[model samples]
Target: MAVPPALETPESDGDATSGGPEDLQRQSWTRRTFGAVIENPHFRNLFIGNIFQFGSMQMQLVVRSWLVFHITGSFAALGTVALANAIPGLLLSPVGGLIADRAPKKTIIQSAQIYNMANAAVLAALAAGWLGVELAFWHLFLSSFLQGGVNSIMMPSRQSMISDLVPRDRLMNVIGINSSGQTFMQLVGPGIAGFLIAALSPAAVFGVMAALYFFAVTFTMRLPTKPLYAFAQSDAGRAAKQARSGGRRSNGFKDLKDGMRYVATDPTIRMLIMVNFLIVVVAMPYTMLLAGFVKDILHKGAFEQGILQSVQGLGAVGGSIFIASSASKGRGKMMIGWGALLGVGIVAFSISTSFWITLPIMIFIGAAQAGRMAIGQVLVQSYSEEEYRGRVQSVWFMQFSLVQFGTFLVSILAEFAGPQVAIGGLAALLVLAMGLIALFVPAMRRLD
Candidate 1:
């Protein structure tokens, strides 16, 4: 497939009419306030795909958390399951990124979805008693590992593909819409999953997830076959030449190294990655502890856990809408700064014994989390060069995966310190880290 012409790169002059800082600021305001992604066909398809993908993924997450707790009745198993997912991404992300660069991104993403479908199917079959056997903990671990590997590949391609689908001016808006989709899935998917699990079996939830993947595959197939960026085409050419010459085997590690070098040298990109790392490491683990919060801490049940998760998703949806409609160019940095205040919200969640109070806190946490994530994605996508997009995206995936590792660490800490204390401590640490980040990372501090 032919590659699309690269969109004109955004100039750093900071003018609105002249492609300067002022211009970018004005454009940013428009992007944040409106649903800009609807204007692009490719992005529209991607957005639809994301809705299905995130809905399915989040549903699985909720179900898995419920399942592990139901079986083991321990918080550590949550950490273990999280670890199983993270380890593979950390190990394989570089390769996934490299493959995305050298091969057809659409193809890689499609294949990953297929792999995920297969995993989901296996889990469902096992659950449905069609493949009856002693399903050990190792089964969950293996499935998580494969899913993580697929995510490492899928994320970079998906992130890099956004710029291809829209003009540079619209990247933030597109990202906002993307965030909204994820948040929406979070809101609806988990609630549905919870209801289904309550009404039926864990296997039924897996079957629904498998069906969602089929929808994802169908949506992805509807996307344009062409490579989203010029650099991807160039990378493809280089890979072909290398393959013909037998110079080096084109694999993920080589691609990962190249991506790391790019990020290492670029201060803006480095800052973005670090900000993501800090947030995920410090604040992301709260989701893993939800079951504990509901069951043990709050003295509630599985149904309440699902409600809490849904409330968080509601917050994300609201934040995504606000960011999507707001018109501010350099506001991404501001969003990061302000969004970090979510740590305070999480802290409140930890301490609040009242369900009413905890519900609002979870909502704020979700909103702030969505805002931070949307802004962070826009910053990363805007700063990366088109040719190295896959590698860059892979690095993004690695950061998220590694953050999950950090979350796992937090889970381990919870095992010792207890869930409430661990969650509250992490939230405080995140607030402090955000302050330090704002002070140190100029890109994260300045608003255009």
Candidate 2:
């Protein structure tokens, strides 16, 4: 019920009354752009660490999807790998959120990175034939499954830690900057991974990915072990300490139930979750099916797919920065507009047969996605109470699992009706869905 320590100091106005035009402009620009990184040492570390974290993830996405498609030559198998990754997140992410609320976030983050590094190392060994085993499809699937579980457990802490590190007024700015950092990695990591896969081997790409994860771990190690608000005179703080003292089992389920009830009762959180979930399930499946689509429809190979992803990242970087610099008003409308644009871009992409044409469309899709994510996340973090933030993010993250399930269904459709038809139809559906939501959800449109 009390104000958080992080929110105690409001964002600086930076001499709006006396400063000259250039001074005011510079102050406004810095506040919107890099204020979080410049002001908070912890957040700066997290920002740099995320560069490595996202690099490994972006590369893994390209490599793993390509590996499955390359080995099995089946759209169904690609969807299966996605599904394998989604299942653990769906089942356990709430528990992960609970752990995040109670545990030392730095420890949780470091442990997860170590696990990911090990997973990548094993995959690299198998791919290189150094493990005396051929890299089988099951091995990839198993690694995906395990990694998904770890991510579900780790992501809540990582996301909620942002609020711990900065003031409430700067939440949107920092979140956008974070998105841009990840997008920047996307811009280069995939292309590099693709080139490595082409020049050397998949094993070498995996090896590079493992090293990136290690760097991420080292950076995360510099964050404070305890949260900024850990000693605040609040029930959540006490609960955190008690939970850490090995009392979690007795009240874990109760905490989970309480978190769910909190989300269920809050209309803004509920609407945001619904809209995000719909977009993920209806509009995002194209990504899972992208490799097969490129191969079958665009007549491209792994390098081409990676290039497309990199191009998308370029769009994402521009989009995230734009949102970060924009006024934090009408964010709900911004989210809706971006979501609709994403559908429109996907439709364009699905209809295009030429790789060159799809290149520009991928950029459009990437920007739309970045906008949708940044705005939607800002709204969620802004509206949720500090104590319930981690649990809220965990529930929000369930969309990942649902999107994978959507990918599986879309993959089956692609197998039967061809990638073009399946993808195009889904894009049309997303457009229609967003339009209806905009028409009916007036309250959501009014949210800032």
Candidate 3:
């Protein structure tokens, strides 16, 4: 497929109508990279909605992790709660993907936001003592479980919706842009969350998250609904005909099994997701156990954790922007490169004890995480047919929950070897594994 003209690489020309040579070049760059998506009002609305969601999610992570640690004060407990949250994704992401395939994407997204808003509000209410029940870890666990379920369903719909909103050729560029914005939010959200938690109670922090979720709802309402149901070759028409003829079966398990079978059969998508899974397994436990790292390893507070998280945001922003501005050729090599870079950062992070040293390394870690995961996602979407897009993405996204198991393992290793050595040693092994794959896996290296 030809690349979309809107997202084609800009050629520098000394044009006088728009601006001078330098100014024209900058404008051309912006047009090719961002304008391809932003110029479309629907994309703009989707971007805004996603910004609120991403920011809210980051802030929620900070607040929730802090709360969990405050109450339990155990790395094992924190890891367990994180694992509990992953359970829902393991069980429901494919179902969500199936829904994304068969339903209105925007409706799925907006509905999830509404439920998330309610969930946040309830947590806030419990913290405020309005619920007439004592706040406990179980309460938080319940909230996490519900959020996980909704997220599993909502994410695929939102992801699939992007392909419908823009030309297929522009999908990766737009995903790059969106992931970059998400990384940017990671920079801002946790800093604000730390301050909020310090100044007020969990009630106020969660109330703010509720407000952000509501903003996501309002922002989504502005997006064009046309694309939510947009399907090639009149898919809706075909669906209606099938329904009338009693030819279609609404079987969730069958749909999910078929999606799994499809992914298992495709090498590009299979390796892309598998490598992504391995990387996340090795890299994510640090963030999940970050509170323990801060309190036990660094002897710091929530504020310090926020700073580290924000530093990651900085690295991720740089990494994501690089991909967004690129011509997107040789993406397979790019993914492997980012994976290797990720291991390098994690090893550095594992060995460092000082705040200053870790800050710089955190940026590298964040960049690698964003770049590798975003590229993997782009490949997953690109390799699938429209008819299977939702399910394909769902099956791919299920790897998201695998991090829970990784975190669980990290908790055990941290208990025995401490956070620094456990994470660092694991990361070193991850780097070696990635290098071996790059050297030997001809199919993976040939992804583009």
Assess the local accuracy of residue 315 in candidate 1 as a C-alpha lDDT between 0 and 100. Answer: 90
Model 3 local distance difference test score: 0.78
Q: Report the lDDT tens digits of candidate 1 across residue range 63-143.
A: 787777777887778677888888878877777767766676777778888888888889888777787675556677678
RMSD of each: 5.7, 4.6, 5.3
After TM-score superposition, what is the CA distance of residue 199 in candidate 1 from its true location, in Å?
A: 3.1
Clashing pairs in 3: none
Worst 10 residues of 3 by lDDT: 1-10
> What are the models' TM-scores?
0.83, 0.86, 0.86
* Per-candidate clash tally: 24, 0, 0
- Kindly state the number of residue pairs that clash in model 3: 0
Please give, for residues 1-448, the per-residue lDDT of candidate 3 as tens digits: 3121122112323222212224324565677568645566677788889999998898898789888999899866776677777889989888888898778788999999999899889989998899899789998888888889999988888987777766545556778888988988888887778789889988888899999999999989987665532344365645643664378666777767767776687666667778888888887777778877878877888778878887888889888877776665677788889988988998887777788888888888888888887787777776665666788778667767987788778889989988988888888888898899889987777765
Task: Kindly list the per-residue Cα lDDT of model 2 for residues 317-404, writing each as its tens digit.
Answer: 9899988777667788898899999999999999999999999999999999998998888888878766678889999999878887
After superposition, candidate 1 runs with Cα above 4 Å error? 1-37, 66-78, 132-136, 228-253, 295-297, 412-421
lDDT per model, in order? 0.73, 0.83, 0.78
Point out the higher-scoring one by lDDT: 1 or 3: 3
lDDT of 1 at 74: 73
True-structure lDDT of candidate 1: 0.73
